[model samples]
Target chain A: MPHDHHDHDHLSASGHPYRKDNDGQLTYWQTMEIAIRELMVEKGELTPAQIQAQIDAMDDRSPANGAAVVARAWTDPDFKKRLLANGSDAAREMGFDIGPMHLVAVENTIDTHNLIVCTLCSCYPRNLLGLPPDWYKTREYRSRAVREPRAVLREFGVDLPANITLRVHDSTADMRYIVLPARPEGTDEMTAEQLAELVTRDSMIGTGLPKSP
Target chain B: MTLTPGSTVRIKTMSPLGHIRTPHYLRGKTGVVERVLGPFKNPEQLAYMVPAPTRTLYRVRFEMGHIWPNAEAPQDTLDAEIYEHWIDQNAP
Candidate 1:
């Protein structure tokens, strides 16, 4: 195995000891990440074009597309029906496959809510959302996401009472999730484009709800 | 002993049980013999740089609810490649 020259600096991004510069850069960790990424390219493990491809593809993230889906769902009941009937197909109809991921939606109601986690490793639906946030793959997230989902959700600003069921979704299988959070109030007259703007990635991931502006 | 060919796994190290690439989520869970597959060589030691004698590998299936009750899922099946060494008699 190729020894990671950035092993020492990687500790910062690994959630152990992170030190920030006055300008707020990860500094040493960033340096190491660049070095490691460059080394992987130099060794032909990954190419500069591949890195650029990923960068170019970043804006094409699934969350953004999911937001548009939600916007469409909100506007047209037929679209909503199609979405619920076939998650992956519905996403494709909107112009993309949630990727290789199997899209499963968790419907929320006045009485229950859903949250997702990958207890073993990060098994996110990259097709629909692109790469997952770093925090989603931590040991703390893996252990706690299953055991104390309610508590973890609270940290993300979701505080539901005991009467409201807090369902935790441990993504152990090939299946992945995208929470269709309830559309907030005052969006009745909003255009699809306007509504899509309000749908944040975190909200679709079930970490929060779209705010009314 | 049913892990088939071409499946991803999550292996861990053990003493008597030997090092198996079973995910921690299904560590103690028991799965029925879905399908008995070939005697492929274990990849744990190779992946982790142990360089030990190769062992048998198998594919196993587990219920999703069994792994995570809070999972908001419509179906209930998770198939994974598991080494025979990690299986315990008490698994069920």
Candidate 2:
């Protein structure tokens, strides 16, 4: 049998020394994260159980929850009123607790469209719609979304009519924001469930729109 | 200072060292108070895992042309939530 050499030194593409741990096992940041977490737990800042519970809560959410609320808002005028008035309370009414972060739902109208972004950081309505997309966290998007919103919307394949003005909401503070996209023209006859299916995550972010028909 | 909706206010030009929620571009810019989002704990201090005092936050609206004067469209608008401390009652 040919001699099998199993040991091969692996190096990170960037040639960063921090990529390797004591035994070349874990990355420096990974090791540091573990150290910090363990220290916090040891110091009684927070228990591992508390961290796990928060993770579990986050894992339980998805875009479908927000879509369901949007669909309900489309079907029921009363619910729509409530959702616009107080988003967190309205979400709770639909069996979703949006945590301590106050959520604000802004409606898209025929005259104007609304786009949401966190220029300072990726501050999003995670309780209602789960974690944000990778692009939403990028610096390119964060800066461009506020500086040139119409251009950014175009890149997302959202070509708006000149008659309609665009409104960009930079979520720089505590209140989380979600866009209530306008109901597609041909989706009037669809059931709430059917309508929910057309409500894409990007639509709620104001980067795109619901499926037409 | 509490500002009613539709009243114009200017963002202060102070960038204190440490965690800040206000964006650099919006500093010293003028905008109208879209809505008062009520009082909340100061996030600038909260970021450092320290106790924070409650401060009033307002949703300030800035016109697109005003924010980016050279932009193609003048009808557009942008909104950002700013704390009461970072705003001046008088607009420039």
Candidate 3:
């Protein structure tokens, strides 16, 4: 069996990961998805291999893609300008195919701080930053991120000074936003790759700052 | 009406029961157009799998104070992308 080669600690009897939703109870959405997938496969609309490949491609995307872009912007002023002007093209320049997503890069400066939230639904830059954090999809985060941004940021351990202006972006429509966090001081000697190491996923989301060197 | 960047406009307050991209909180709120994000298919029609006409979308910026009276940071701002049909050109 497939379970023979896998670690038993985290695997269920079915050899699938132990998740709350995988408790043998199929949800309505899950039922619909399975039925649709099977029908599509039977009708030759899509092959099982094609579906698996799509899933694999999505799983391959991570925050590291966004980190590399941030690092490049920090080290190269010209690239940073281009990134600020047109984020989609800048990401494409790095060889990351973001598809038809319209990306907007908002800069975080000493006097300004940017935060992103989708009040209507979970509209995220998945192509660039992978899937959004679970907290981002929560109703509380979606509601409070715009109403009381300062308090919400403080909850995430990001306390801003009164002098700094906060800008909360609500992803209501087509465009996806990424915060271009300010570079931490005293990293002048680091390479672009080394700088990417400090760029955290939360920094790009505007919830937390980049790690200090 | 074509809205230029830096033009002050108010979001139309309409609660049509359907798949709308506009959030309820932004209705009747006034803001400045920060940028014109070009034209895109109207999501209202697209959600129903029907033909949708392209509409110009704008990035509108609003001051926190204007949105909420008891705003913790009055100087802070909020930005959202609004479709052309949702925006009212006449701003008092």
Give all candidate RMSDs, comma-separated: 9.2, 6.5, 3.2
* Candidate 2 TM-score to native: 0.87
Native contacts present in candidate 1, fraction: 0.02
Candidates' interface RMSDs, in order? 7.6, 0.8, 0.6
TM-score of each: 0.59, 0.87, 0.93
Indicate the docking level reached by candidate 2: medium
lDDT of 3 by residue, A18-103 (tens): 45554446799878988999999999999988988887788777888999999999999999999999999999999997888899
Query: Which regions of candidate 2 deviate over 4 angstroms?
Result: A1-25, A37-50, B49-51, B90-92
TM-scores of chain B alone in all candidate structures, in the order given: 0.61, 0.93, 0.95
- Whose TM-score is greatest here? 3
Instruction: For model 2, report the TM-score of its A chain.
Output: 0.84
Question: lDDT of each prediction vs. the true structure?
Answer: 0.65, 0.89, 0.92
Question: What DockQ does each candidate score versus the true complex, computed on alpha carbons?
Answer: 0.09, 0.80, 0.93
Q: Write the per-residue lDDT of candidate 2 for residues B1-92, one digit (tens) a residue.
A: 75899988999998899989999999998999999989989998899999999999999999988989886677898999999999976555
The reply for model 3, stretches above 4 Å from the true place, is A1-8, A11-29
Give the winner by DockQ.
3
A118-209 in candidate 1: lDDT tens per residue? 76668777778888878888898777765566667789988767676655555544456777777778878889999998998777766777
